[model samples]
Target: MLAIKGVSRRFGGKTAVADVNLEIAPGAFIGVIGRSGAGKSTLLRMLNRLVDPSEGTISFDGVDVTALRGQALRDWRARCAMIFQQFNLIGRLDVLTNVLMGRLNKVSTASAVLQLWGLEDKAMALAALEQFDIANLAGQRADSLSGGQQQRVAIARALVQEPSIILADEPIASLDPRNTKVVMDALLRINKHFGITVICNLHSLDLARGYCDRLIGMSAGRVVFDGAPAALTADAARDLYGLEAGEVMDADADVKWAGQARPASAAA
Candidate 1:
């Protein structure tokens, strides 16, 4: 489990995340929801240590991850993989090679720099590709693939890391509705089958409601609501999303999607 205590992040004079506290349990699918500038991305980046907190600490299994540095930091990053809205693969690299980059944190610098992967590493990457049903595209360049294909490739890359936790920052924000379902279903499979804790930042309430067991709402950079998706009332959503709460509350109001009305787990 991971514990976030009074965590906050600021950029110059502006605060991006403020005094947020939450405990993330294992094998849980939790969605952080809010409109733009709500600090959801900042929260995930802090968890992955891509951005250091301005105050407070984040600990995993009783160790203060905020204090980790050098090799320890690298190792922690490998254990905590991140999936971004924009698929962050090297455009020039083949899909298989892009996925093998996940193993770089665990390999020697010489091997990594030379792109010399072991048979086992190649096999693992290939298997991850196959898991996402993208094995045939392994030889294709990342930039040449469609957006959905690229995102799946990104997910496969994250899977090859063998992470204990995955922090997805708007993984489906840029995809079409069909691709959105595909990506969300893929994340659900990862969380359920592999028992990896997945904390994702999402904008669509229907998608979040359908896939995530718990939903955490943010407003003005602080957590305002944290509970089950069904427990998230329209009133609470109003506080989370302001005028757009109507969209957040009514799943079918502005969007047409088959991803609504899924059951969620009991609150942790």
Candidate 2:
């Protein structure tokens, strides 16, 4: 289990995340929802150690994740992979090379710098691309693919890392409707087929409702609601968004509240 106790993050005078606690089990699909700047990104960054917590502890299984350093920290990062909104990839490199980069931490620095990928590594990367139905694009430049294809490359790269958990920060925010559905389906497949825990930050309540087994609602850096999607009542949503629940319902065709917390999901 992944356990967080009293976790918080602050930047100068601003508290990005505050006194947050959660226990996430393996193979669970969790969706985190909140308005922009409500600490959702900061929370995920802290989990991957891209940002350090101001106070509290995070533990994975029996290990103390907060105390990892140097190689240990790098190892921790490998175990907990992060997929970004922009689909971070080496645009100049071939898709295969970009996927091979996921093994950098496991290889010697000299070998990695020299780009000495063994046959086994190439096979591994090829297999990952095949899993995403992108093996044909292996020889193509990463920037040459469509947005949806590039996002698939990013997911394949994460798979090559063999991570036990994936933290996706607005992964489908930039994709079109068709691609959004594809990406969400890919994430679901990874979680179900491989038993990898997935914690995603999402802006679309519709996508959250459709893809997530459980939802977490945050307001002003604190968790306001946590339960199965069906348990999220109208009153709970009001407290979560500080507005009438209907205002942010993604299914509402006429919703255009100034505080548009949830928009219609591209996946829908």
Roughly what TM-score does model 2 have, to 2 decimal places?
Answer: 0.91
The number of the candidate with the highest TM-score is 1
Give the clashing residue pairs of candidate 1, or none.
none
For model 2, residues 60-104, the per-residue Cα lDDT tens digits are 998999999999999999999999999899999999999998888
The runs of at least 3 residues in candidate 1 whose Cα sits more than 4 Å from the true structure, single-residue gaps closed, are 253-268
Model 1, span 1-268: residue lDDT tens: 8999999999999999999999989999999999999999999999999999999999999999999999999999999999999999999999999999999987899999999999999999999988889999999999999889999999999999999999999999899967886788788879988999999999977667777889999988999889988888767777678899776565553244334533333212
State how far residue 29 of model 1 sits from its true place (Å): 0.3
Candidate 2 — worst ten consecutive residues by lDDT sum?
258-267
